[model samples]
Target chain A: MIATRPLYTPLDRIGWLNTTIRCVLALLGSYANAVLLGSVIAITLSMPAKDATMSAIMLGFVVQLLAVIWVFYARTLIGAFVGLALPATAAAVVLHLLGASL
Target chain B: MKFDKPRSLRKSMTWVHTWTGLPLGWLLFAIFVTGTLSFYRLEITQWMQPETQQASIYDQGQGLSTATKLLEQYASDAEFWSIGFPTARNPLYQLRWRAPEDKSGPENAKGKAKSNAKGNANGHAQGNGKDKPQRGSNNGHNATSADTAAKKTNAEQSQPAESHLAKGADGDKIKPQQGHRGMMQLSLDPATGQVITPRETAGGEFLYRFHFQLYGMHWSIGRTIVAIATFFMFTAIITGVIIHRNIFKDFFSFRPRKGQRSWLDAHAATSVIALPFHLILTFSGLLFLAGQLLPMVAGAAYNGDPRGFLRDYRGFGAEQAAPNPNAAKLVDISAIALDALKRSPAGIDSINIKRPGKADAEISVTTPEGSLFSGKQSLASLQYNGVTGDFIPATSKEHSAAETIWKFMLSAHMGLFTTPVIRALLFLSGVLGSVMIASGLVMWLVARQREREKLGYLPRGHRLVEQLNVAAIAGLLSALGAYFWFNRMLPADMVDRSHWEINGFFAVWGLCLLHAIVRPHLKAWREQLSLATALLITIPLLDPLTGGNFIWQNWLQGQFAIIGFDLTAFALGLGLLYATLQVKHKLAKAEVTKAVPPASR
Candidate 1:
């Protein structure tokens, strides 16, 4: 038996689409995380408002990088989507409850 | 590792990288190149304004006194005055005053009219000096010569009155003076109180603005586009790293002249070598524009009052205060400057006096931050009671931890406070990043061409990408050369000369694109690359002809910044010349091989 390469695999196209979704999710998920994290620190921390704001901004970059890396390392597309969406949603709810504007 | 899986994560990452990078590669190149040049922006501006002689050294107290005297003479009734003392980079005292409401119009017009008359008087004086030989000097003609000289002096003295009358007649036709606005900038000689009129040129400022705002677009739109491109760039760099399994190996491996393999190797090597710089520059670029792009966080926190957040983050309140109406005695500004220098030793960067000659006047002297990495937080400033010239300790506040970190990141991104060696390293990294993107674009075309070659036919899209690669990469260099050439060649007195220089830049770039489209890809590459080579090489040669200081003179004077620019241009020109020659040689060899077919063998 001889091994051969497929000329036009449908799975490759599906994978490309999954990667695109992952990228979009990573971006949105990280943005939401930055906002939620920033507000929580601002409201809960005993530090000055400016200090908390700076900390939140710094964490934003870190979370964004992690989220992007997670998108690639997750086992499946659905798994990655769920992994990102859950935290993003939890953070959003907390922020809303805290009366955060965005 | 082992044999490849059919649906691997690495493959997906590769797909993500390719798709994200290819679309914005050209823009990234432009941004990187211009941003790199901005590191030397001050030097470029210094070279452009060659007529302004560099102030060798000046007593700080003397310079401050000169500034104070000039302000007293020209703007005693003004509400606010700012004095920027001479520095190594800029050798003139930059003074600006905000006029009082009552003094802004009629007083300003009268002042301008008087200055115009004075200028005419000066011109007539020069004319009188030139006609001395024609007045005759023999003993018999002495009386006539004396009479002629007296007549000429009388004419010179009357010239100003005549010009003033003519100016008044045409005053209605003249448009309202823009100088009637609140603030007016006046450049003064540091040693003397006399004003110095420097010629106008955009110089390095255009390149600095071009990096972010681009040209011929609203700044907001341009910044948004740049932010978006920066986001994609950040993504692509991440994906690219994730996909590269042999990252360390790729850093050491480069094979030149192997066609597609060479392109791939060069791209990988350049990317890996400057990977850290790419990551930092992209992330920090996005952060620098975060106020515009990610305003929601600040908005949510402070009810859309971004300025409030910035004020707190910077640890300083606004520089201006409401003016006191009561008249007050003014203290010597030089005393305050000297006192501030005694406290900080680095000398003052600038001094701001609010409500000058008023009871509640405030003076602030700012010194450059000692640490190069503090960004906006590096302003070590002292506030003084304007009337007493006594330091006010309460005005200087310590920054919070958050503000310090934010300032550090911002300053790091701008490369402010960088030593020459660090600046050179950053510049080299930027160049490598540019080359990495250019080679990546070329590799895309090469890969497609190879695939098409297997099928014995090339696609139209592949040809288009090839042409675009040549036009964008090589054509941009040629356009930059044209921009520098135009800076030296444009008429100094032409209206809106700066805009014309920029227009010439775009026009030349547009012509290169047209040439790229019309000619074959190989021929276009060779021609544009050769043109860039010639233009870059001749820039230094034309410096002397264009009234700019020569490279050798700059070298002799220990002006490393100007010499660095000329040497960099000469080296880049040499590199392009080498590339052009290689391309020509390759083409000739290909033609010779074609002429002697394999059938002859």
Candidate 2:
């Protein structure tokens, strides 16, 4: 989405230009991605297993770590899509395989 | 610095408030309106469920007695037996049994597994006497007491705290139990333990579902949406305050006259005056649920130690457990658990026994009472040897002061540990907040119309804004009204009643949008809002027609839940009617003034 009449002002644009905004956004992105991914994993794992407590806790930790990394490095929209999609796809496949084998 | 405000300061504040409010105004408006309606979710549910109308208010004493009997009937050593006392809107006692177990299953799953699967069909207190100890099911010890079980009564004059417990087995010590669970409310006849009113049938449940689509998708996704919406809402409220400079002057400036100016003033007045409340509610809502939404930040920031993180934010500790799968049978639940909980660090109002009939199982009792905003304070779990009947600690360390602070903040924000009177106040305030948002949206539409007339052909910017206004305000109102209709109209015996109810909510909302887009903007707003007004007004009327009455026949019998619904519906109906009249007057005046040319005078 291109800027529709520049929501940011000159001062506001400068504020975004400041290094701190980038860092904050990056951190927030990483955090958000990790939470989103982990939550997805937690929920998906919770589906089949009669006991989801342990899985929810463990998957929550691992996914969060991965999400943080994805947020920091993945800059473009395409990158973000891949960053979110890849882990989710991988997790689903693995979980399905685990369910089948069990 | 002199505190006196200059014109520049006034102008700057106005700019600040406007910018702050504009971006997130739409989302906040949705939140406020939905949330306010959510306050009477139970009442709405009662109005919807006609079958539950007669048996709405369960006898408290009878309910408690039945729950106790059910506890004994299910498992003598059930780790916890929690009961939700009946409220004005939902007069049903909810009872749940928790049993201690090992990581695998209940302690005696192999041999002593009593087939509760059979007793499941013995629903709604059929008086089959099947629970009266059959020849095969009965052990040697039969302490089944049935005296005065049906005649449990409550003195209306007693204190709220005193009312929760029956005269103890000894008629001395008061037993603490779980209070109401708002969103997940299910009405059951305290007399029969049969599902008198399923939560799926309740109106509040739809709001709960809408808030978090507990459907095909995962909870995390819903939580994230709710969180992001809350974040945007906070930002908008803050910006709104900054953008409106002359906020105080417009506090009482509501002109119930016909014009866009009048609309703008009303909207500005409500939002500005209650700005502080709106901000507090949104920020606090996010804060209350931060752990669920922002867990990564919590985990990473606290360095993978869930305990540390909880300690810092929620005053809760990870309950550690040492599994003893081969323990003895559980002790008397009502007596043993309460005794142990009293000994524990935090006070206990609720207890959960996982893996009943197990050797190594946990008995987790929590006292969430008075622990709001403290994150996870008032949680103390005791893992006991189910076989040996020994108490085991869930965690070693207690919550720190900082964690407690976080818990308190959370509790206060959501009014978690508050009394009924305070909760009612909060609920009222929530309604006001919703009205404030609705009025604001209307004001924007009114202002744009004036601008449109001046510019001719309605500027693209104005048209887009106006369309969005119709879609959000009118569309949302119609959807909400439809939810009530669905509740009353849907087949009571429909399979998957809960799922269908939620589907109905979204379906109606979708239809509203479709209708709005096709219809003229002005007509859609008036018709839908007027329909909403009628539906709200008719809700109370439906009660008596559908078996619920506000008269002595119901109220004298302690059927407060149904009566409360009728009164609340009537109140909301009046509010909607007032708003509709205001809008109609404005439209009338605008048209009349336009028709009469100034030169004729």
Candidate 3:
């Protein structure tokens, strides 16, 4: 008997839905991570007072790092979400402690 | 359009990729490596020059005062005394003075028209008797001679010796003086006018030169090459992005198994992960030479004034006019400027005196310590009148928003302003960048190994590539390690000591390549790598032996450049050792698996 198989099996309906939910979660996580990291950087750089431009740069760097993490683990959507979000949340909390208004 | 066969298109595209990348792959690899290292060239200099280690912590007040006094005394008649403040990488305060009439003697001269005939057969070798009679006939010449004789006889006059004009090969009167370039550090005693620091040649400047100007080429040629390279690099990055459709997927997909597959995976991963860095670096490197490449545009748009373009990009006023020649006069209160600088809230780093003591002379103050790249392009400056000590009405845009952004970008690129943590991060990224290249090179070899075996002759093409791989990947590192060894081992009193060190570096590198060509290929790789690893690890040990501080002390004292060099060398050594181990493991496994028949193996 001859056997034929694919390396990756096609996703069932439930599997497809699960993957979609995970991917959406991952995207949200990445966004959150970026905001949080940006906030931390903004707070650290905000000498004397908080400013808009420095905040923007911080946001950009955070976004870049988040994108890097997300892209690498995107196939494992949930893993990507967790990997990105943790850094973001941690940064946000740290910034809050450091007296960032936002 | 009709639908095309996807398979044929893919094959053709693959071929295009291979052909495009293969030719410049090694050159590109070297550029990336050296460029990364060059980011911290100043720090590297500090690490290598142990003499600088004794310099104390930066004291702005003392440094400024010292500079003020020094400049007032020595550069009082200078066109400009551009003082460079001490930093983490360079502890010594450096100053440049462009004075009138070539201040130093002929000993510092670069080239000389050899005195072909020591004595003239007719005692007219230097000048004929007729010319001497003409000189005697002139009363003005007699008066000048009498004044010079009186000055020589004076007990108090500590002025430099009078220079006698020499006849050149063409019989043109030549005023032979030191032809050496850059600033000379004057002696401690203000009146002496002697050299104290033995005059350091600009080695770091050469690295800067190499970035734009390659060796064995004129400045124009080098600049054109650099400009073109910069332009193509920018285009390459964009094309690379277009080509890497699955960049994300390849980021973490490193597989160091057998030959071709491993190299491909390594290349993909390195090329993908560092995309942002590569893009920024290539663009910025080009941007540095923008004026050279776009001279026409700059000239047309900015009224043919290069300063106008600089002002637009950097957001600053034109620097104060350079002082006119022969209008210099030493001012009183030399300490005043230094005091004012020290009192500034942000703190002062260096004080540059342009055309010292002249009416048009300007004193420029700056932030002293910064990243190598950032320092080359100053962050902030305030200019003042040299004679009056009045604040010159120059723009302080260096303190402005746009200028600050430029400084930050420069700092980020150089891995300086962000703290030690960022430098370490960048260093790791650089290592990954190197690995990516190494694996790619190896992959090419593996891919063709089978073809060579089938052809009965190990093809010359693959062999050449392999030889280059060994030479570049292992050879460069070994050569650099040897440079340090030579620096320590060569007798301290050796003449032209630094040049010897540089020569030693190239010599070792040349020998490594020679060995690669002569020896059987695998042994060359193993031996060179193993030896390089040993030498690298041994450098830190030699530092302590040479009476330099121990690694622990350097680290604890926050001597980052010093400690960093040792740690970097140690890490590289370990890396090479690891690679050697991998090679051994693979060879052993291949032997065990009997992939080749007993007769062929």
Candidate 4:
């Protein structure tokens, strides 16, 4: 086979397991972070309530996309997890302080 | 850069692209095909309902008078009436009126209302066929709910209004709906003013809804599934770009007949060509389904009842006096239309009355108009008092920057603001997007050839993937072709004819899947695609043979929508034929290679 090995996958059991974890992180963790980011923007953006919510919701997808890429690109699983968690925690705290319900 | 890490950005992205794209590729392909065709949903409907095609050669005065007569005779006691006059795409003289609440039977009302709602579903707001205008100022979340709230206040459906009180910003949402609820309709021949009951086919609406909501199952669940798949597609598109090492160089490169390389090149070409459209459509699709996908985003801010957020997002409350049910003659629609024409000069498209037989009724004469970047089409409309025939000045709200951005993205996604030429380009872009997805899916199978060959024969999973490639790609096309044929061939008055046509689509698609599983791979591709080709090529003939005028005759009548649909189908069929010939040519080469052994090589 004269094909290039640039896109090769050396998926041993541990690597497969690692990929699986990242996949979950990309889907679930990213979404958790995204809604938080969106909520923060929706509440805090100085525009009208409707515009703020809309702009935030639309921008949420971009945040989610980046989070997915970050999950795969992170050096370790812990790094990926913490990257999402820290911001989510911060946003939750802010919303809580602002009397946002849930 | 030389860190001893397993992570390579390009490698991971390439992996992500494949995994995310492959499983959802077939679903995305189906969505693209249907959504692309939905650019001409109204046109497809016009073509499908040929009984009204040759009847578009009448004057606007006649069209309005017929609607007025119909409404006066049959719908005197109705709540509201909407008249969609003869237009280029909407060739039928449409008269829709909501029956007074007590008169409407639940069972009869749901079917009749839903079937007619299918017309407004696509044409009125011009987005995803759902009642919500993507970004219309008269966005129905503000108007219809307010209108429905006035009616349903006695019922329990008025709970969304509690959020309005909490927000206190809805002081401008008094817009009344054109029509909703148990609305009955009449589609008359505009040329002769005769009743033209077009056959009950799902028409383009089934495809439009199925693209997002899918079929058979509960709509919310279907919408969620589509949303998740859409997110996966969005990820794949971005990663696909990241993984393309020489994206620019590869974009222009094509090596035909080189198997794997050719597929890759085709993938690259299609992806690069329609990159902007792919991104816009995928992202906007997520936003379209966002309410289901991320309710928490809106919920978290709006006290876990996002109705407040939705109300504001769709814009706010303006109070208007409700119709008192006191009978009063409606002012002449022709006079209102003439006044509206004098005001706009571009001419009126529809006359939607809030209360047809009441003194306080409002008449809105909407023109076929829009600025492409501003918002959805049909923005230029004049409202009038129903009895005194006074023109009601529009309380035009200034669009916020945020709303403008939202509107721009939405209008671009809907392409409702496009010229005919632009619409064709958007459709072409969608076709390219579909080809991109299919080629990438095929490349996954092709690139795995060495691994399979090294195992001496195909593994079960690889075999399944091979069968799916045939079924999902060519087989889906075959189903769509069969759907069109069923629309022509089915007995029009047969009960549940539309459902039968859709079922015929799935049934043919299921047969193609069975054939794929049973036959050799190449043979399955050849047979299904050839069937699709044959079916599509004869669509032009079907138009004339099955109760439609000749293409030239339609041209004479200025009924260009059907002519356009027929020509487009023929062109698509030609393209498919070319693809079929290529597959057959490949099969021929395989046959020759097998005839001689490795000794010859």
Q: Estimate each model's TM-score.
A: 0.79, 0.63, 0.64, 0.85
iRMSD computed for candidate 1: 4.6
What is the descending DockQ order? 4, 1, 2, 3
DockQ of each: 0.23, 0.05, 0.02, 0.39
Note each model's CA RMSD in angstroms: 13.0, 13.9, 17.6, 9.9
Q: Point to the candidate with the largest DockQ.
A: 4
Sort the candidates on TM-score, descending order.
Answer: 4, 1, 3, 2
Q: lDDT tens string, model 2, B1-601?
A: 1111122433433433343345556656666666665555555555565555556354533554455454444444444334444545456654443333311232112111111111222111111111111111111011011110111112112322433343332233322221111001123464544434232343463463344222345545655666656654554465456456577688867776657777677667766766666766775566434555555433432333333433322112334354345545545555644565467544434444454545644444444333353333333334444345666654554444433433454445445556668767777777777767666666665655545556545555555555666667766776676676766666654555545656676787677777666665565667667877787788666656655574466668876656666677667778768867765764576467763222111
Per-residue lDDT of B181-234 in model 1, one digit per residue for the tens? 233455555655444443345667677667775777765678778877887788
**What is the DockQ score of candidate 4, to 2 decimals?**
0.39
Cα distance off (Å), candidate 3, residue A61: 26
Write model 4 residue lDDT over B311-389, tens digit each, in one string: 4443322332443768788788788887888997766666778667777777776666765555542354477888889
Candidate 1 docks at the CAPRI level of: acceptable
List each model's interface RMSD: 4.6, 14.9, 15.7, 3.5
Off by over 4 Å in 1: A1-46, A65-77, B1-6, B53-63, B77-79, B98-183, B189-194, B245-253, B316-322, B394-401, B589-601
**Of the native A-B interface contacts, what share survives in model 4?**
0.54
lDDT of 2 at B517: 63
Pick by lDDT: which candidate is best? 4
lDDT of 3 by residue, B1-601 (tens): 0111112333433433443345555655555666666555556555555545544544443454455555555455545555555555554555444455443433222111011111111111111111111111111110111111111111113332322112111132211111123223321211221122321222333333354544445555665666555544443345445556577677767666646766777777876777666656655554455445543223222333433444333223325333365565544434535554565655454555555665555565654343344323343345566667776544422344533544454445555444457666675676666676666566677777777667766667877887888887788778778877876777654555556666787799889999888765666788888878988988789877874678987776556677777877888889889977876675576578856323222
Estimate the overall C-alpha local distance difference test score of candidate 2.
0.47
